[model samples]
Target: MSEQAPLVSVIVPNYNYAASLELCLRALQAQTYAPIELLVVDDHSTDDSVAVARRLGVRVVQTERNMGVAGARNLGVAHAGGEILVFVDSDVAAYPDAVEVAVAMLAADPRLGAVSSIHDPEPLIRDSLVEDYRALQYYYWTASSEGSISFLFPALVAMPRRVYDEIGPFNTQLRETEEVDYGHRLTQRYDMVLTSAVRSRHDHDDRLGKLLRKLYRRGRARVPLYAQRRRFACGFETSSRAGGSLAALAALAALPVAAPLGPAGAMLPAAALAVSIIADLGMYRFVLRRRGPLFLLYFGVVHFVVNVTIAAGVAAGVVRWLFSARFRRLYEPDLHVRPSAAGEAAT
Candidate 1:
């Protein structure tokens, strides 16, 4: 604890994640970093999340209605009294050294505005290969020599109190991708660090349906960020390749309507399906190795569905951006700074 800087507040946002939230709370109580206050914000959970927080003796904030993750986090930030704010998901458990490392990283470099800990969790998804691939790709992406991050994950992040002031709070309108939006703004103003030493482990189930939903939301959530011509153009260039493949398949599916090219058009759909299946096999093998055969078969199909749905959503988001000015403006709420102290609370 530094006398110069006020305490660090660790805020965990929860909604019907009682089981996972318990592990997270326990970990916070045992952090190596002292002088920290824990604030658990429950967005009107049906579970006894408030009771659990009370049992732990942490400050509890409750919303009358179910606000999404971003809104809950905003509420927590509003009530936090610490000079440094840390957001840890209810589904994750921070290692004892987690806060210690992040605090040191920010303290040593006055210019570094934010920090995200490495997530080192045991893989639970049935598809081990796909899980490994996702982890590896994320690892490589964040493995910058400068210790600076291009993006922030909501799972675990720490930063100085001044950050929220300059940039803004998590956009209340966003159900997801709020962290990424905030990260872009932070990078523009201050150094955003992805500390390799700080570690946290995510503890939760990633059932096939849940995974698909998450990816679908991710693909959909990226729409607003794509509104800027340069960002949108780059995004479309990549997203189109993924999405166009599926669109091509659907187009080929319509070929049976042509009497002359009936069988040939059918081949197009078959080819598209084959390519997508093979792609998933190769892409997900790294993460799905541990799952049993039955799980693998189901997860493989689920993965494809998720990818296709996300790609489609991205395409839709892009169209909305172009056709609707209101959507484009609202797509990136963090970009449009409104006059409010709530927005000014945490950085």
Candidate 2:
């Protein structure tokens, strides 16, 4: 007699995303992998998300209050009944093979604590410039080398139940970027892989205003995340870009003062700004080639706006971290479970 396949529980945490809930669930139901359980943890959603989950014949766990994504995920894991836990966001549509691929990778390598699918935002990409930019960004991210990753976003991730038990639950206190924190903990002991073999489509925010707001929120989240930790992987790329953008902005701001000094002084700032622009354009040259010159018209403006908003958000986060006791208290000292407790917890 052949052994039965391990159960895989797909946990989805949602809040006010009724429009995409059905599609997300349907995609999971269509997975090639068998012995799967669906758990939808609603975070006090005002919409019809709970009803939709029930109609789909999935288990629905409603939080008493809004606990954010991290909290909702923790609750879902607590109630989950599977040897392998897979997290899928309400706005993500996983490919039929996504779970099978991830599970295979985890089974083949015990050191791999988690695996996340390469998110393709093609479906969400529209004619709008913002949407196009978002799509290209996802494409670039997904194309990255398949190896150990710093973190895995919940959009579509799978890991053995033992990994979760060892790592404990997602920190409920973090309102944003909790995945980064969780990844940091996971990576300390085991590998986290991001593979292009598995795929999923993300219903990304396309509107410029909404996209900017999301960036700002991410920026604000960084403050507390940075405050609590001395260092984090996968931040080098972002920090380098933000640093370059700020340097360019400073050069432009100083242009007026330099103008009063002389041609030489003014030329220095001009040269600095030009270098920044050239670097940015070089970095996004593929985008220009893909979308044509029209993309260039919006590229600079979008880059500047995004960087400025993120800077403002970071500034706000810093202020709050310094003054707000509540913010400081939310930081978790360690996300990893003790070695001695790991064996006990895993069992």
Candidate 3:
């Protein structure tokens, strides 16, 4: 409290999240942090996102085309007037003190490059069991890895303007794994941490197909980044977790192949499933403690399906990487400054 608080700019890169934009903006507006400016970069949403932001009386910028989240965020930074930059996704409603706490953490540590917020186990808006499962899974996954992290949770993160200057803007070519590439670039120089002190509630994917597709794309897209690293990041996504998904997937795949062998062949899939479940035993236990036994059963079933989907995605990505030139070049983009995130019609 002794030094003057730097003006903080909160940038929201949105894509058709009108249902929860009000809550996101309201919670952001109520932040205890001082000297903050809010801007929403609508990514050609075919919804009322711009209208919602306008109704809430916040500055709105529309993209010329759907350039992806990274482009939108870059535009927000262009328009932002704060020394501190905060990125809050449209579906996430940050807690009242989220910004204040995050800023303090950034200021307290001169070596810290960025701070990523932890999400509550519950969703911002209760929609379905799938969302609930995602919220809890993400919450536990992140909460278990608080402090000194390599993965950047772009959903709710803060950084000083100087850090942005040094590291440069996000690689716009990285539509799915931009954060992963950015985090890798960032931690090589300065420290980035995932802390519980900065917390928010994210309205995660609520439908099974929608959730699986997103996870699958992210799973496949990240193969190139991991290929470059030759290893997974140091945080939540671990070798053990990847193994669990693979095991679950192998089990699902072995079902028909082993069916001709009768009960003896069933052992392969059953054993694989058991191994997969055991691999992530801690996550299931965390769910059990929080949601009780009944919900835990549902959680297990849903998670098994999710693991299979992730495994499939990674496999697909691997195949593409081997065969397709464009797929392998998913993360190779020039990191130079580009024009406004929006098209000429940007307002």
Candidate 4:
């Protein structure tokens, strides 16, 4: 961080996750990069999250009500004074070089709008089943072996002030996928980079219900984006055409197991079930290496349950978005076509 330029502001949004919040703030305070204003938005937490944040001496904004992550992040962005705005989750611990790399990367390229750190997939495996599902999803979204990408998880991403000017703040209505959608808009105008020099530790949820709920919300968020025919960011799981179908098929195949199935009739559905399960397992291994044999077995069961839940939610969201006229129009805001040649979708 150069002394001549404006300072950087790191915004962290927290709910009831007090333990995670403490870890996150501690990591921020210990950053090698110093020109940062740390602001923690307490979204009307019922727990001691506010007290914890206050104890840490970071600027705390207490919301009157519980706004989701997007809302909280927008609030933080509004209060940010830095030339660069970095958004971090309360549950993540930023690597020491987190701020340094982010600032340096963005400063290097005038064309760059945003830069994100590499998140190792260790914390996501603490709870084998749930963590594995979430880890797989996270890896699918953020992992890249090559150069910079346009969109990524906003968990530990940094963007220039110009990004907010050209694009805009996150959509408050979208509790999930707001980062993905916002990143897409930024990428349209400026380059989005992924720096190997930066990193963060993301904590994973071990609970089944929480994982299922998250997947459900993600499914709902994707409705409008996909309906508008937006080019997707992440891989197979995030895409509507591929991951969406997998989710739907997984549910349909499960119906036979719940009810009765004749031996011959059962084979096809049984085979489909096996294939889907195996495919997900393979994806888990390939994208996120199995921690161990025991961890893999437990994670496999959890992954199976999580995917079925996600598939069902995605199917419902897609149907609702496609059928509702208002939703379709809202999502697919019409483009003002210019008189230019080859009037395909505008950049």
**Cα deviation of 181 in candidate 3 (Å)?**
0.7
List residue ranges in candidate 1 displaced over 4 A.
1-6, 121-147, 232-285, 288-301, 332-347
Q: What is the TM-score (0 to 1) of candidate 3?
A: 0.96
Model 1 lDDT per residue over 280-314, tens place = 44434543555456656665554555556767667
Encode model 4's per-residue lDDT on 1-347: one tens digit a residue.
55675588999988988968888999999988877899998877799998888888888887777777767777787777889999998888988888988888888888988887767766722655566556655654456332556555678888887777557657665567766667667777888876557788788887778777887777766777766655666433344334534744655676767456666565665665666655555455754454666766775566666667766776788887868876554333232111112111100
Q: Residues 288-326, candidate 2: write the lDDT tens digits.
A: 776667876686667666666766677777888889987
Candidate 3 lDDT by residue in tens digits, 109-170: 99999999999999999999999999999888898889898889999999999998788888
TM-score of each: 0.76, 0.85, 0.96, 0.83
- lDDT, model 1, position 126: 29
Candidate 4 displacement at residue 114 in angstroms: 1.0
Shift of residue 266 alpha carbon in model 4, Å: 3.5
| Model 4 CA deviation exceeding 4 Å by range | 124-129, 144-150, 234-248, 251-263, 274-282, 286-289, 329-347
Judge candidate 3 at residue 258 and give its lDDT.
96
Best by TM-score: 3
| Candidate scoring better on TM-score of 1 and 4 | 4
Candidate achieving higher TM-score, 2 or 4: 2
In candidate 3, where is summed lDDT lowest over 10 consecutive residues?
336-345
lDDT of 3 at 305: 93
What's the true lDDT of residue 195 in model 3? 90
Best by lDDT: 3
